[model samples]
Target: GVLAQAIPARSHPPSARSPRMFAWPEKRGIASTVIRSADTWQARSPLIPHEAFRWLHSELRLALENFDPSVPGQEWQGKAMSEWLREYYLESIHHHHDAEEDVYNPWLAALGAEVPPSIASDHRELVATIEVCLGLAKSLVGGDASAASSLKRELAGMMDVLEVHFDMEDEYYSRVLVDFNVTQAEEGAAVGRINQDMGLEGCRVLLPMVVYAMYAWGGPEVVEQFKGNVPPPVWATLESDWLDDFFCNNLRVIRRLQGRAEPELAEGA
Candidate 1:
């Protein structure tokens, strides 16, 4: 696999405390567990905000970890990783920003509060930064070792911008959504529209990524929210097909890089 080729096995044995740190199957089960634990979908608050942030943070962290310039052979390895991250950034973060600007912002403006221009400007800047990173990644892939350092710098800059941007967007939007008395159904519908716009192929990739991020960073509340929001068949396909194949492999590489233990999957799952 691509991940296995990139990240070598750890020299030290897995410790009892962190037995499954890099364990993909165990983490995959977390999503299943979250779904199974939910008895109902009674909670009606919008989950898009929390889930978006979770996915953004988790994806960025994973990219940064792998993009670390100090890591040997990052020049070549980072090319593929960066390409993957670029696609994710576009499909998730960029898509989210577009949705906010196109749908949420206009809707809120109609309701009385116009979203700040600074947020839109931030999106533009972030888009440029992502392009720079992608360009650097392309250069690295073309055998330019020096481009690795530049790619790392761009990724760092992107992270800084995103941290501020995410906070600002969340605070501003949360307040507006509250003030406008937007219903959970409305939010869900908006997100559903956005997903539909993304098309089937996009969902095939993004859905699994979303689930993976939810498990990684969403904690209990977010997990419950995800379980509530997502349908059973959708969740099943994401878990069994997409996640088990795609995300789990990459996550295993990340765990190995972090020197985490690989936990064993449960008996049945």
Candidate 2:
């Protein structure tokens, strides 16, 4: 009913007066489409992304603790710490905002929804914060001990902005999707397209970051949801390689600092 109302039926020639509309792309391949229809389709679950963000928030806090100068045996040095923050910023936060700006918001606008300008403004602010942190991080790369304290402060500020930005995004966009009755299949397709556009190399770096963060924080449901959407070949690569020793090692370090037990690195049958 919502789809029919939002999008008029196909006609001989597209009407000049017809409402601009959005639909899931049909070109991603039949297998993906079928999987989405059979396995992924459902009512929108806004909490999944929200949970992932919360996990990221927690991970950053843990990282900052490791970076603290007052802490005995500082676990993270300038270069390694900087790289970690860069990876999270680029693969997670930046990509997430870019997807909303380029795909999600535009799609809603085409569907005649009034997408809020504040969301874009929030992204800009977040980007500025990220850049500031990154610059501080770069300065730290030469083992500047003094920069550690400043880097930690910058990270804390970034976290503050992220908390508010994520809440706003979840409130507005998630509600819009639910209100419009956007199928999970459609949402999956949109996400799939965004990943595809990133190319294989980009996926190599980003996919694991996303999977690790979501799995570590969002629990089993989020893990299964993401795994189900991944094709078998890609899923195999993620398990066998991308999320291999390095990811597990990082997980171990983070968990140790937080006084948590080591989680099973791989999902079991």
Candidate 3:
């Protein structure tokens, strides 16, 4: 059985006296520990983050198509396209890349993982583009029904960047984390680092976004698996306001785009 411990606050040589800490945290601490094998990590592909990438890109495509045909449905069902981009799209991805840098990059680098330089460059370019679009989205307040073709074209460009970036990221994760035999403890640290950085405030939006993405692309089993990997409290939202406010409303825009039925918790995801 693996002896679990906290993630080290700083790196140290993996000597018997000083080594990297890797454990799933619990209320009483690492006193009673149980760790799954790499098989648990291997059961998934591109890991949890990549799952969100797939679903979010799918959502982006839906958004772009809906907006392309004249931006008609602004008021009835859910958020306006621009509003969704401002609140969710721009921020969600921006934070995702940031977390990868702050959380995953150090650990992966230490593990001798080979990451392509392009992924980091893609993240920077994508965030800059998204920030500019965020400002445009802000101006188009109320998901402005009269949004111009120029804005729509901006979204198309965003979708192009987003879609290509997703494939690149997925490839990177598969090559680095998946085939490289990342330990369950290491994976646990990655999850732990993500949860810690997101904190409760960030989780209010970001966690639900992850849950929604998992629910949409991966289904119930997949969503449950994803939920289990993170801190349990993130999903334990009182009344699930996170889902209704952060996830469902934006998802409704996608449904409205397709002329589909309004969202339930199921649809919201």
Worst 10 residues of 1 by lDDT: 25-34
Which residue runs of candidate 1 sit more than 4 Å off their true CA positions?
Answer: 1-76, 216-221, 256-269
Q: Where is model 3 more than 4 Å wrong at Cα?
A: 1-47, 68-79, 142-147, 178-180, 246-248, 257-259, 264-269
Cα deviation of 124 in candidate 1 (Å)?
1.1
> In model 2, which range of ten residues has the least summed lDDT?
17-26
Q: Could you tell me the TM-score of candidate 1?
A: 0.69
C-alpha local distance difference test of each model: 0.55, 0.58, 0.56
Measured by C-alpha RMSD in angstroms, how accurate is candidate 1?
9.8
**What are the per-residue Cα lDDT tens digits for candidate 2 across 21-134?**
211112221111111221223312433444445565777687677565335565345556666566544356677777778987887787677888888898888777777777
All candidates: CA RMSD in angstroms? 9.8, 14.2, 12.7
Query: By the TM-score metric, which is better: model 1 or model 2?
Result: 2
Question: Which runs of model 2 end up more than 4 angstroms from their true locations?
Answer: 1-46, 69-76, 212-222, 253-269
The residue pairs that clash in candidate 3, if any, are none
